[model samples]
Each structure stands twice: as structure tokens, then as C-alpha cells.
Target: MATQNLIPLLIILVSAILACVEAQTSDQTSWAKRNETEKEVITTLQFYFHDVVSGPNPTAIRIAQAASTNASSYLFGALWMIDDPLTVGPGPSSKLIGRARGLYGSVGQTDWGLIMALSYVFTDGIYDGSSFSLLGFNPVMKSGREMAVVGGTGLFRLARGYAIANTYQANANGDAIVGYNVTIVTYV
Candidate 1:
């Protein structure tokens, strides 16, 4: 009877030891695989987009005339100049690295709300293919509006990220200056 009891105990002990060994081996294999994978790079890039919006073009007027009053409709585009806050000016600055094209429209009263799509082209910096594009709505009277990064090329190929836009300045004539802070992640 004592022998029978010892046999069961011995079997249990051997099984436990084998399980522990297998677990350790799996852990080591998983760690090795992680080391072989490429590391992800995280970076924050700051830039400003100063837009000088005036009035709607003929196309803008046509759309508004079909939908609502002209005062509530606007279609505009601007050349974004990338610059630091302290040295914000027209044309291009030494810090100027890229330009963005934006198309915006207002559907509410006197351009109270706007929907926009933007295409950013970068000639300098670590961005791939010299550019990345994004499309989303411009939240009216709201700060820190977020937009999705659709696609990119070069270093930004298969890129995925988000951008925050804030209005830096607005004039009575409807011209405004906006700031953009974009954060991106990619594998190197």
C-alpha cells in the first residue's frame, strides 16, 4: 500500500517538472522572437499653417446658391507656410519645410461651421515621398480638433498617426491662421 502511494506521488512530481521545463522553453523562444522584430519609432513634429481666406470662388458660390444663402456658404484654399510662432511671416522662412493645400466649405449661417480636406506636401524633413495627406472636418470655435492620417509614402509609407489643429488667429474678414501639431509613429 505504501509503495502504491509513492508511485502516484512520483508520477505527479515528474509531470510537474516537465510542465515547468516546457514553460521555460516557451518563454525563451518568445523573447528571442521579440528581439528579431523591428523597433517602432515615435516622434512629435510641430508646424504652423497660416491660411489667408478671403471669399468663396465661383464654384463656392455656385454650390451655396444651390444649397443655402451665400453668407452661409464658402469655398476657399490657402498656401500653408511652415514657420515658428516667433517668426511667423508670409512667403517662406528658413524653417519652412513644406506646403499644404486645403479645400474648405461652410454649410451653416455665415460660415459658422466648416468641413475641410487637406493635402500636405513636404520637400524636407524625414517624411517619406515628401508628403502625407489627411481628411476630416474642421470643428468650429473648437480647439484641438483631431484629424486622421490617411496614407503616406517614402519614410512614412504604411504610416498611421493623428494631427491636432488649433486656430492661432482670426480676422474680421474671415481670414485665419491655424497651427498644426502632428505626431507620427513608424517602424525603422
Candidate 2:
């Protein structure tokens, strides 16, 4: 009876040991594979972003805002969800390339700053079906704003880099066209 109990315990112990060994071996194998097959590639891309907030067919819309958001000079606490178009040029009629879809909120009280969480999904050329994530602060009032490129999918897998945005045009209604220069490093 005691031997039967010991048998189960021994089986459990052996199984746990095997699992641990397998996990270690798997980790080592993956590390080796990554070292052998992965090569770091840096790519730079330029594009234009169109943010239309007030038009018949707007691409960006104000989803939420705080009670005092309108009272602030910087429109603090205003949150927007956007699906803006990315084009080859600043003009609306420029060649469509991708879309910038995500959320951004005014987080600055004394300045026009936004906390943006966005993904640039490419739909043209070699990058078709690939997308990279951007998450960082955007000081809109500045001449150039830099944001981090955190991660990506498809061809941009394991991507990390930065994006520089410069406002090309802005109107009274808050619609704007911005130019983006992004540099990213990805493991291929």
C-alpha cells in the first residue's frame, strides 16, 4: 500500500523533472535558432498622415473628453480614436499606402501634448499586411515630435525604432496633414 503511494509520487517527480529539462532544452534551442537565423535590418520610410476631424467623411473623431477639456487652451483630456490615411505625399489625393489606427489623448495641461497608442498598418507594396506599433508622447506644438516604434507583425516582427513627425499643414478646425519619417530595426 505504501509502495503504491510512493509510485504515484515518484511518477509525479519524474514528470516534473522531465518538464523542467524540456523547458531548458527548448529555451536553448530557440536561443540558438535566433542567433543563427536572425539578422538585424534597419529600414527608413517616409510617409504623410492625413487627419480629418471635421468633414463629410472624417477619418478622426473626438470620442471622449473631460468636462474642462473645452475650457482649457490646449484642449486637455480630449481623447480621439483615429483611422487616418497614410499617403505618399501631404496631399489628400496622394498615393494611398497605409492607415494609422489607434487612440490618442491630450495629456498636457500647459502644452499641446498627446499620449498616442497607434499602429501603422501597411497595405501597399512590399510591406503589405505588415504593421508596426507606436506608443509615446507627441508634442504637437513642436516643430518635430518623436515617438517610439515598440513592436510589429509580419515583416516588421521584433521591430524597434523611432518616428519623427512634422506638421505640414493645419487648419482652424483642427484637421491637419503631417509628414512622418520612421527608422526601424527589425530581426529578419
Candidate 3:
């Protein structure tokens, strides 16, 4: 009777040990910390985003108006072409690099919340395009606003960065020509 009980106990002990060994091995294989000597790459990118809202038909407009006041929420889609000449206006050889699409929720007369997605396509790079998301509070009446670059694709697999956006121009209809200064720190 004693030997029979001991046999069951022995089996249980062996099984527990094997299970622990498997778990630890798998955990080690899944994640590894970076070495101290591996330095991160930082890049500064500048671009202009042309948002047209002055024509009889425009790309951006107020989708909803505020219930009590003149404030309105807008949904806009714009293509941010790469201005190779570093000029604010459209150029001849300007290539399409990305698109900025988002909803602008008006909180105040000049204050708005932005939920935007940026998709970038590298025409002459290792891989095509990678996308990322942005959440920010933009004061259209102010000089600039800083937004968070939540995440992105391709070479920007684990991308995280910040963007400084300034209003370069606005027409009578309140359409915007914006400038972006982005500092990206990412690991591929």
C-alpha cells in the first residue's frame, strides 16, 4: 500500500519538473535584450502637407457642426507629397510618400483633437510602405502643436517618434498648408 502511494507521488514530481523546464526554455527563446553597444538611429524629416479647402469642391470640410456654437468637426484626407526641393509648394519631381487621413474633433473655437493615420511608401527602399497612428491636440490658431507617433511598418517596424506641425498657410476658407518636422527613433 505504501509503495503504491509513493509511485503516484513520484510521477507527479517528475511531471512538474518537466513542465517548468519547458516554460523557462520557451521564455528565453522568445525575448532577448539589446546589447549596450547597439546605438539607436535618429533621423530628422521635414515635409509639407497641402490641404485644399478653397474650391467649389474641396478635400476637407466640416462633417458635423456643434450643437450649441459655431464649432464644427471635420473629416479630411490629404496626400503629403514629398517636396524634394524643400519648397512649401508643389514641385515638378515631387513623389508621393504618404497620406494623412483623420478626423478633427473640435473642442473649442481654435482647439481640436486629431486622430490621424499616416501611411508611408518607400519607392526606392528595402520594403514598400509602413503605417503609423497619431493622437494630438492641435490649436489651429497657434504657431505649432506637437503630436505623438504611436507606432508604424517595413523599416519602421517598432517606430515611435514625435512630430511638430505648424500652419504654413491658410486661405480665406480656413484650408491649411501645414509643415511637419518629425524626429523618428525606430528599430527595424
* Ranking of all candidate structures by their lDDT, best first: 2, 1, 3
The alpha-carbon deviation from the true structure for residue 78 of candidate 3, after best TM-score superposition, in angstroms, is 17
How well does each candidate superpose onto the true structure, as a TM-score? 0.59, 0.84, 0.66
RMSD of 2: 3.2
Model 2 Cα lDDT, one tens digit per residue, 83-172: 999999998799999999999999999998999999999999999999999999999989779999999999999999999999999999
Show the lowest summed lDDT stretch of 10 residues, model 3: 76-85
Which regions of candidate 3 fall more than 4 Å away from where they truly are? 2-7, 10-14, 33-39, 69-96, 109-128
lDDT of each: 0.61, 0.95, 0.59
Q: How do the candidates rank by TM-score, highest first?
A: 2, 3, 1
Best by TM-score: 2
Query: Which whole-number lDDT from 0 to 100 does residue 15 have in model 1?
Result: 100
Clashing pairs in 2: none
